[model samples]
Target: MKNMVKRYGFNVEASLPKVPNHPVESKEWLYGRTIINAVRVVMKAQDVQISIFGAENIPATGGALLAINHTGYYDFILGGIPAFVRGKRLVRFMAKKEIFDTPVVGSLMRAMKHVSVNRAAGASSMEDARKHIEAGELVGIFPEATVSRSFEIKELKTGAVRIAESANAPLIPLIIWGGQRIITKDIDRDLGRSHIPVFISVGEPVDTSGDPEVATQRLFEAMRTLLDETRHSYESQYGPFDGGEPWRPVSLGGGAPTLERAKLLEIAEKERRQAKRDAKKAAQAGGRRNPVTALIARLKKLIKK
Candidate 1:
């Protein structure tokens, strides 16, 4: 497996500490552990080199809110590694409801106790996350809500700050770099063994008890700074960025769109989706009102009888 210690700069192979016998030993489930093990196997097969910094920033125990910047699909998986390294602490990430509605994956998500958020009715999911944190469990939230096509931190939602405040939990800021190279929005997938280097950085907890807007802005700045530093370090170790790298941000001279352009693209995509939904509804309504179609349906029912 490429020598876990040598390949991965982080010490994820270390033996986990023994948890005291209790009703909920470590608050971890067997299914979740199996999933994580499978992920590890996949990572090994792909030879992903993971480097973690500031893992100690993750609280060893108690309720904490992890506010992460979303850059790629794998950010959710990589973001939880720090807490796992710190003390095998499993994080219940708040993901969109569509993912929770999938077949096998949905059931696994429930078994892992991850929170599902319906964008139209997010209050219930937010409350669910707040309760998880209040119950002394670590919960993760992508403040950006979606993967940034520009490879930069997007305008963050205030839900993170509000949840932290309500739960009286520590708000931890984190960022992941290089995950976009593996798989991201509007990019070709690369699931092969490319030996990609993924960096995860954890910043100190932010104060969320203040004004929600102000706190969210502060959290944004913290995440931005962390991302910047992580990007610089990645560039330094992996050789200088020679402009036009799709996985790099425009600010760093990459081929990715600028923040403003990316926003425009996102708006256009949203409009297109809305139009498609409207058309589908209109077609369904038309079908119900079609007399000939209705007659065929009635004849079929009579034949069956």
Candidate 2:
């Protein structure tokens, strides 16, 4: 692991040519058909089965804001494939800038006319998303900003609602289950599992005409419900949540981290911290060597005696 980490240390900041964004046009439908069909072929080869529901809830035409729960790296494909295949439309996702900076991915995203967001650049991407929305593009966003380590829906960012309101587009809540177990940020949890069944549930368009904060909360609630339903659906077909839990780590067949292991880790961490503090205190006491003051004190003591 250490060698692999070191080998790939410099790739993130490696120099890559800038990729320009392509404007959405009539040809996009053709691109969507080709790309989505290709993805389905590949997934079929891997024996990956996908079940998508509420797809008709997506607006057949015009722009819409897709608020998705990010699970793992394959989330884009998982979310995009179902939407594209069902709706016969491509969703322009607001992806992280790093993806747009990578060599091949950057080119593909630009070609797909997806918006690139540099989190540190503040709200600059909002305007870009709004522009795409105004152009009648189905603009999708993973509102969690990043995948949650626990496989649970994390707090959503307000960007999706803001974009929806600004573009006067309806906000559609989407939930994806079982993507996290395939690949995850937690190295110990990732088993590189394939042939897993993934489920996607799309909710009706959420009204975003109200306050952005309120609308965002409403979206989160809807997404949470959809996520629960999707998880239940996944488990119903697969089996128990213990050994085959979709929300758990891949190591435990995707079950959540064990409580006993967590408790043991906590105790060990506390002991290590306490030992470091005690060692620091001992060193401070041992290093108290003020020779001049000690000599003067001893002479004064002798005179008094």
Candidate 1 global lDDT: 0.83
Candidate 2, which segments miss by more than 4 Å at Cα?
Answer: 1-30, 187-194, 244-246, 249-254, 257-305
Model 1 lDDT at residue 19: 35
Q: Roughly what TM-score does model 2 have, to 2 decimal places?
A: 0.70
Candidates in order: C-alpha RMSD to true structure: 4.4, 13.5
**TM-score, cand. 1:** 0.88
Backbone clashes in model 2, listed as residue pairs: 248-254, 248-255, 248-256
lDDT of 2 at 129: 93
How well does candidate 1 score on lDDT at residue 89? 74
Superposed Cα deviation of residue 109, candidate 2 (Å): 1.4
* The best candidate in terms of TM-score: 1
Residue 251 local lDDT, model 1: 82
For 151-264, candidate 2 gives per-residue lDDT tens digits of 666677888888889898888998878777667554344433366677777788888877888888898889988877777766677776557554564444665554454345
- Residue pairs with colliding backbones in model 1 are none
Question: What TM-score goes with each of the models?
Answer: 0.88, 0.70
